[model samples]
Target: MKRRAQGALEYLFMIAAALIIIFLAVRYLTRTSSTATDLGNSTLENITQELENAGF
Candidate 1:
């Protein structure tokens, strides 16, 4: 019974660690995507301003 309990505890710890890693990965991806979106938006705005200046 003691051995079984130990094994269960080990599995629980492993699962917790995996969840933390997955969460971090997802957070990083989300931040990167947001940054890319912001950069694209800024670029578009710059282009529009330039076009207006050229009377387009």
Candidate 2:
């Protein structure tokens, strides 16, 4: 029936939207994690340089 077809279409749309959201979330998380890692590495390097300069 036409109603059944409409119901199927709605379900497909919802699934597609959900997938897009999930993809965006994963991308955001990856970006944030990389940024955090870069910051940590920079901090470590600075500390190491400071320690060496102090004659450690």
Candidate 3:
């Protein structure tokens, strides 16, 4: 009985740790993607302005 309890606890701990890692990874990915999108938008705006100024 004691062994079974210990095994269950270990499994629970591993699962919790895995969940935390997954959450952090997802958060990081979302932040990175948003930053990339913002950068792309700014770059596009700059290009448009430059082109308009050059009468293109």
Residue 41 alpha-carbon offset, candidate 1, angstroms: 0.3
Total backbone clashes of candidate 3, pairs 3 or more residues apart or in separate chains? 0
Q: What local lDDT does model 3 show for residue 19?
A: 100
Off by over 4 Å in 1: none
Off by over 4 Å in 2: none
Cα lDDT of model 3 by residue, 1-56, tens digit: 99999999999999999999999999999999999999999999999999999999
Winner by TM-score between candidate 3 and candidate 2: 2
Q: List the residue pairs that clash in candidate 2.
A: none
Query: lDDT of model 2 at residue 43?
Result: 100
Candidate 1 local lDDT, 1-56, one digit each (tens): 99999999999999999999999999999999999999999999999999999999
What TM-scores do the predictions have? Answer: 0.95, 0.97, 0.96
Q: What is the lDDT of residue 18 in candidate 1?
A: 100
Which runs of model 3 end up more than 4 angstroms from their true locations? Answer: none
Model 3 residue 29 distance off true place after TM-score fit, in angstroms:
0.6
RMSD of each: 0.6, 0.4, 0.5
Q: Which numbered prediction scores highest in TM-score against the true structure?
A: 2
Q: Encode model 2's per-residue lDDT on 1-56: one tens digit a residue.
A: 99999999999999999999999999999999999999999999999999999999
